[model samples]
Target: MERRKFLKDVLKAGVGVTAGLTVGSALSFASQGKIELPLPYVKLDPKKVADRAYDGYYEHECAYGVFNAVIGELQRKVGGPYLGIPTLMFWYGGGGAAGWGTLCGTLNAAGAIFNLTCKQKDFKAMIDTLYEWYQTTPLPTYIPCKGNWCKQPFPKGVSHSPLCHVSVQRWCKNASVYFGRPILYNSKERSERCARLSATVAAKVVEMLNDYHFGNFKPHKVKGSQKTKMDCRLCHEVTMKELS
Candidate 1:
């Protein structure tokens, strides 16, 4: 009995020591400020990223969901600097910045991902590409499987703008779903729609990141002119980059 107790204690001590060393190493790396400004990129599978974001939304809503989908994957794939990032901080970005309905939380998270991975000179272009694609594309295009939270097919719509207010309102209008108050927003369909949308956005971000890393990144070109609010042309339409 004495010898067995001694062995158990030794095993516990060994585990504690190993855990301490791992944590200590992480702390030391943070203190040294060695995490590079543009964090290293490794190609990621977009499908996997989408699945992660879909699940993440069930836990933390849009911004944190999309952010974790990418960063968490990085932490898993490349352990050094990524493990130090406090991903939970992004939880505040949900509901278009705490339900104020400003920039879409997914876009906010995607912008951050681009900033962290792309070069300084390329950042603006990458953002432009994403915004344009988002504005024009029919979102929530990723349909969840039969057993998933959203089993039925949901309506899709284009925001024509990046604001969450516009995006969600436009989508709700298309779906004929009312979602402003807490009760309305809490509906299963609404939650599922956002979850799938989060997945779609995360997948797009991963695709862009992979293309950028592979040196095949291209700014999406506007094929034809599209109309925005007539009065806001000076601010929105007259820009050199065309929107379609």
Candidate 2:
């Protein structure tokens, strides 16, 4: 009788755990900026991660460049919940979130995946650095590396905004691709550029994750031309409201 009762209790505990995870995942999807609680994460190789981003971009033509790149590694290294997960849902992240042109799809994937493993305290700084990097750096640096699918040396441009339009416009300006001039910004080069950028972002996220794992993650202040006037107390106020 005691053995049967113990088995029943174990089954109940398993159900409870599954229910908790379901609730957490639902909340995660609903709350965009909120952090998801940390999950067990393996320290992925930064170089390999970047390569996957590059390859995946070319493979799927969207943030799948970032998603498929890392998902395979996650599946191979840490394969429990990630097993058999389909990329179909993530397809909408392309062309600025299903062609609406909002946030860069690469960054979107990076943020979504990053939050899954990063602790709450570390999420903001990592994302801030990534956005700053995207805005200020002349990108697609990985394209020049050997074995990259895109071989042309396109003009480099700095996008002051992380929005897709600004990034594409800057590329267009640099390449001199005007309104009836072959739309170089929308050509194959543009896809390659985004793929490379996705790789860069993926590698950096891996670096950050490793640092966090080792208790060495540090955030530097990012100061660019544009600054938003956000109140520091708002985060605490929001948390209080949520708790209430």
Candidate 3:
């Protein structure tokens, strides 16, 4: 498969999988009896790595936020897959996908990391957990050490879906903040939330990957993920109920 297609497929299903060339040694994994090469990565502490990513979110925004966050962590001790990546390129994922509001950019960033550092099989396990966590959990979980928003109350809300529009909308509803506003998409509050979210995601991914390396990782048993009534579920058979 082509790189972009692979990235999209993995990410939409839970990943990018960031698409780019790497300077580090590529690791190959067996998939369906075929040997495939993937992006390079080194082992890391999950929470510490995530904390690093959270800090990066404040430096950049969603796409770049998590991207920079993970990259920063990687570059500190190891350097290869991220040598030539463009920093500002992926910010387009903001407000869904590139201003289109499709998938959350933070999710996009997570996908990129998996594609670069892990196997395809790992995507579902780690990415699925990440997506589920995002959907069911309260966001902006990370707070800046220095900022007024740090003390401000970050409302809790669950986005039934992962679309940026719906995620932001759900948060707005729960917080009761976006009902009437001059601008809804851009705000310090929202940015702060996404940053925290980005950090949370990166941290989760790091832990998942570490578990995979250590053979302790577990994939979720739930099926049909991050979809609008999953296509797979469409064909699911149902048992008959009692009838009058």
Candidate 4:
């Protein structure tokens, strides 16, 4: 009878231990303010941490407008005579409206934020520097067609490629450098992910901007051709070389 009673106590102790662990884990998550949502592309649910970076204006317009505002503020802080209006107009009119898909929108937004904080005059030059830094960092890789941004397959039967999240983090780092304050996220890991996405989008915008600024947009060479003969890739290569 004593042996049987001992066995019962052991089972109860095990159950208590398990219950304690579960409650502890749940409390930890609650303290972090993380809402676990199943994202389609990412293997893990991204923690929805509140950003404590800059307390600047957060607008609900399109990505381009947000980026432009960030860039404008950066230019103004850096002593640009006229608040980077020319650069903003150039990018907004050409890149945002045209929708060139080179850099991701998040990257563009981060770049703009960096520009405002750093007060840097040459946004393009800064972006190039950030890109070089990003090449050295380890990034998350996702199958191209499976993630939130991309759902459709390419023309051929090729599966999705790896999306670089490190680049976005680098952009955020640069922004932090310029802002002179740390933009704290829920955790360092979540901050890194958010930064990476933001930078990716921004990079796409930059690519489009470069194409519009330097590419030779002209009439098609083929007779009765509806499409223009301008080569965006060729133009970008040339512009990148110049920047280098």
The estimated TM-scores of all candidates read 0.74, 0.68, 0.68, 0.24
* Candidate closest to the true structure, highest lDDT: 1
Model 1 over residues 74-99: C-alpha lDDT tens digits?
Answer: 87776445777877778888889998
Residue-level lDDT tens digits of model 4 in 47-122? 1111111111122212444354334433433322323244443333222233443443334454554443332344
Summarize candidate 2's per-residue lDDT along 9-122 as a digit string, tens digits: 655575566557787775676567542366557768889989877777776655777777666677666654555457545667877787776777887877766666677777
lDDT of 3 by residue, 15-48 (tens): 2232333223223322233324355566677667
On lDDT, who's better, 3 or 4?
A: 3
lDDT of each: 0.78, 0.68, 0.63, 0.35
TM-score between candidate 3 and the true structure: 0.68
Pairs of residues at least 3 apart in sequence or in different chains that clash in candidate 1:
none
Selected candidate, larger lDDT, 2 vs 3: 2
RMSD of each: 9.0, 11.0, 10.7, 23.1
| Cα deviation of 139, candidate 4, in Å | 5.7
Model 4 worst lDDT window (10 residues): 38-47
